[model samples]
Target: VRDVSEGEACPTESGFIADQDRETIVKSSMLPHDSAPRVTSPAADEGSMQHNISELTALCTSLQRKYSELQAKFQAQEEEIVKLKDRVKVLEDREGVAAKQSRDDAPIKGGVSMQGRQLLKESVMTQRRLQGF
Candidate 1:
């Protein structure tokens, strides 16, 4: 067994510290007293590393899929928002035209046209002259 310092990680044959050794070193450091370093065969370490790598890869794939789905949903919502804004603009334009048309067709006074006002003025003047008042 190789001698490793307390809290020091042992590097594998590949020159990288194994995940198990890292975890063991971290756990041993958390203890109140120093503990003997646990050793395992190279084959066992390799197997453990492969398993950890597989789990990490699976987790990465799942996260990527979720990110893609969220991105698609975001894009769809953006498109919907644009469509709604355009629809609102069109409706506002139509409302403005309709309001202008209504104003152009509306009477000047309360339910009375210019010609109606002129006839009413003439009738009042003629009645006043006939009554001598």
Candidate 2:
């Protein structure tokens, strides 16, 4: 057998090369297997891919259910806060009315007290003037 490097030449049959030109053979002839090995079936791979997709879909569905529950709770809390705000507004209005009523009553009571003191002073002044004359 003739000695050859890996890419230098074909594994030639001696009689054929001498009979023909150099270009007739190629490097593909040197490979060990004539054809590729068939291992994975398309049907089995498709089933596995479908199973993974189904599991992901179920997980997403569960998350959506949890999100809806949280959304409902948030809505309820928001409504409760609004009700509390309205109650606070009513209480503040009542307090404002009570303060104004106290202010109005104070003026009326002060006026009456002033009038009573003025009448007492007039009576004392008239009695003193008569006693002097």
Candidate 3:
């Protein structure tokens, strides 16, 4: 392993530098002459990866909790809809029963009966005729 100087190109064991390696070399060469290339140890890289993993895990947990809350709310709304539907059904049944009862008691109600309605109509016609229409 000979010491490679600045501006000198070195071939790897594969006899070619990869595009990423070439890019890194170009970037390092573009820095100021007084500044050395920054290097990180393998341990530092591992620590950074661990930190990212922990943050991702926390974000995933938060999203899961939010999803669970939304799902519960949806279920509660569905239950409320079912209860409202049942109430509407009960009201419709009561209205049907009331309508049937009203029909059955029509004659007993007197003024609402067909005969009473005809008499009222005749009385109105008589009054209108007396008043010259």
Quote the lDDT for 131 in model 2: 100
After superposing all C-alphas onto the true structure, candidate 3 shows an RMSD in angstroms of 13.6
CA displacement after TM-score superposition, residue 102 of candidate 2 (Å): 1.3
| Pairs that clash in candidate 3 | none
TM-score of each prediction: 0.54, 0.51, 0.53
So what's the TM-score on candidate 1? 0.54
Q: Positional deviation of 58 in candidate 3, in angstroms?
A: 0.5
lDDT agreement with native, every candidate: 0.88, 0.80, 0.88
Error of 1 at 55 (Å): 0.4
lDDT string, candidate 3, 1-133, tens digits: 5457765657666545477688899999988795678899999999999999999999999999999999999999999999999999999999999999878757655538666787889999999999998
lDDT per residue for candidate 2 within 40-104, as digits (tens), equals: 89999999999999999999999999999999999999999999999999999999999887666
Please give the range of 10 consecutive residues that has the lowest summed lDDT in model 1: 8-17
- Stretches of candidate 2 off by over 4 Å are 1-39, 108-133
